[model samples]
Target: MFREQLARDAARIQNQFDLVLGGLDDLDVTQAMAYTTQGGKRLRGFLVLESARLHDVAEDQAIWPATGIEALHAYSLVHDDLPCMDDDDLRRGKPTIHMKWDQATAVLAGDALQTLAFELCTRPEVGVAEVRAGLALTLAQASGAQGMVLGQALDIAAESAAEPLNLDEITRLQAGKTGALIEWSACAGARLAQADTTPLRQYAQALGLAFQIADDILDVEGDAQKAGKRLQKDADAGKATFVSLLGLDAAKLRAADLIEQGCAALETYGSRADTLKEAARFVIARDS
Candidate 1:
């Protein structure tokens, strides 16, 4: 049931993307934006929708931010796969944007998608002006210098640093790299309703960390075909990851513990939050 709901939500958000992007000029950059956003778990969007459901926000109103988060995520992935970054040739079981098009097109597509995210977030359907402004503000913070970019910069620095990052350093790094957007997505519903976001914030913090740990585990032991991208890059690069810093078994244990903590944080919502708890489990269990 959880997986089914995830698929349904993914379809919904993808449709939203189609509606928005379909109207744009059919340039290569626009094409790349659509292509890059085409497939994924759509986990971040799911968080927005699920949290909105828990808060009794209508799906019509909730979907704007849901789609917004996904656009932002797609932008990040496109940039991350560029020649200057991870330099990956594949993503989501297909060629990266830079491979399909050119580096310039990929860069432009990423930039356009980043701006489109804010446009979607600020749409009048989302809420009152304050809610829209708040969503946009938090998104900028989550994806900008203080958040994912900072994490990426840290990662690049670590690769050339004299020493490999320790577990604590990696934890802080992943909190920004992976956790920031997840936290924002989970809390968006509360922000929409102007409700306190402490519980969802806690839930996403744990879930995001667990998600990164699971990614490290997948990097160590996962099929590249199933993962839809290159795996074991961290190991090849000699970079420190959860699976490298701690043994694989220990890293798995840590992820499980984090999942438990994430689920526990949703106890205030009882059965309404079961899907999110299942999502936390899926994060570790998924191959991609």
Candidate 2:
């Protein structure tokens, strides 16, 4: 059930991307934006749609934020893959933006995509002016210096730090780097409906940590081809990860526990949240 819904949502999101990008000029940066945003689990966008469904929000209204998040996520990846960042050459089984184009084009494309997220959020289809403003404000917080950027800065600093980051520090960092966006995606439906977001927030806290832990596990054991990116980069860089701190077995156990906790948080919605529970399980069980 979850897989089917996920696939359907992925297609829907991609179509929306095509529609959005089709209006842009045929420039290198625009083309790069189109290219980079293509293909992925689309999990964030799916969370937006699903959470919207749970809240009885209309899909038409929810899709704007769903598309917006994907655009923002793509921008992050494009920048992250630049020579000055993670320096990767591959993403989603394709060459990284910087590798495919150049650093300048990649930078511009990422910049454009980032702004595009705000544009989508503020579109009339999303909601009233207040809701749009709220979405944009929260999104800025989630993706900016206070959240994802702060986490990225800490990660870069850790590369040269005298001591490796302890478990708590890593946890704190991941909460910003990864969990912030996931939390935003999960909570977007409630924001759209102007409903309470406590349940989804709690659920996403566990889910995001588990997702990162699962990524750590994958870096150790996952297929690079399936993951569509370089694996074991952390190990090569001597970075600490959940697998490194907790050991592989313990890491897996912790991820399982997190999934359980995430699922438990959705008990208020009962069967309406089964797909989200399945998503929590899939996060750990997935190889990529």
Worst lDDT window (10 residues) for model 1?
30-39
Candidate 1 accuracy as TM-score: 0.99
TM-score for each candidate, following the candidate numbering: 0.99, 0.99
**What's each prediction's clash count?**
0, 0
Regions more than 4 Å wrong, model 1 = none
Residue 145's C-alpha lDDT in candidate 1?
86
lDDT of 2 by residue, 1-288 (tens): 899999999999999999999998899999999999889999999999999999999999999999999999999998899999889998988999888889999999999999999999999999999989999999999999999999999899899999999999999899989999999999999999999999999999999999999999999999999998999999999999999999999999999998898899999999999999999899899977
Instruction: Evaluate residue 226 in candidate 1 and report its C-alpha lDDT on the 0 to 100 scale.
Output: 94
Please, what are the lDDT tens digits per residue for candidate 1 over residues 1-288? 679989999999999999999999999999998898898999999999999999999999999999999999999999999998999999989999899899999999999999999999999999999999999999999988899998998999999999999999999899889999999999998998888899999999999999999999999899999998988899999999999899999999999999999999999999999999999999999988
Instruction: After superposing candidate 2 on the true structure, give the runs of residues whose Cα lies further than 4 Å from its correct spot.
Output: none
**Model 2, poorest ten-residue lDDT window?**
92-101
